[model samples]
Target: MAVDMKTIEHLCSLSKLSYDEEGMEKVMGEMGSIIDLMDEIKSFDLAYDDTKDGNEIRFADTREDVPEESFPTEKLLANAENTDGCYVVPKVVE
Candidate 1:
């Protein structure tokens, strides 16, 4: 599979990346090497068993659902610099 300039440009655009001609060429080369490695791996066949029936996978017991507790309004409001009933941070956007 040939890695063309258009394909590289499209990939960069999707990633919101800015690259000059040299950077683009370098990225294209790296991508080409990766694709080549994948192609090589595709030609190999391994008959490895992935069965997990007998193996015990230990995991922590999940937390049980409990009644939710609400914090006091006065306590919560005290933490806010500018509060009607909630915490307020600096305005980030217009």
Candidate 2:
């Protein structure tokens, strides 16, 4: 893949990223290498029927929801620096 400096500079400007000549050259080289690697991968023989068993095909492990014991409001409120029969938080607005 041939990377143009003008295109790279344009992309950098669009992304609001500052890159000097050296940095631009480095980035262009890396991007070109990545594109070449993708091109190589595209040459591979990929068939759906050739697929085998799934590896680490995981599912969410969940449990039935049940009623749980909770602390008394007074006990929880006692730990607060300031409370009005509920949780206390810093005033957000004047």
Candidate 3:
């Protein structure tokens, strides 16, 4: 698959991005390479054993979840300059 100027322009517009001629050419080349890689990946024959449960096979090495003690709320909020029940921060935007 080839990435043409029209496709690049459309993608740029959709992403709210702008590029110069040189930048566009570079992007087009990179996008073509990515498409070629995807095509190559699609041609691979990926197989999995159906006899075993897929989730059990995939997660066999993972550790079990365990609960632990948490920090006191007062200690967590102690350093705040302005807090009501939580840490206070300055309003960022209008």
**For each candidate, how many residue pairs have backbone atoms clashing (under 3 Å)?**
0, 0, 0
**Stretches of model 1 off by over 4 angstroms after superposition:** 45-60, 65-94
lDDT of 2 by residue, 16-84 (tens): 997888888999998788877888877778756535656544556555578888988899789899899
Query: Which candidate wins on lDDT?
Result: 3
How many Å off is the CA of 33 in candidate 2? Answer: 0.5
- The global C-alpha lDDT for each of the candidates, from Candidate 1 onward, is 0.81, 0.81, 0.88
Q: Which residue pairs does candidate 2 place in steric collision?
A: none
Ranking by lDDT: 3, 2, 1
Model 1 score (lDDT): 0.81
Off by over 4 Å in 2: 40-94
TM-score of each: 0.45, 0.39, 0.44
Best by TM-score: 1
Candidate 3 positional error at 12, Å: 0.6
RMSD of each: 6.9, 9.4, 6.7
TM-score winner between candidates 1 and 2: 1
Residue-level lDDT tens digits of model 1 in 55-83:
65555565657978898888978967898
Q: What is candidate 1's CA lDDT for residue 58?
A: 52
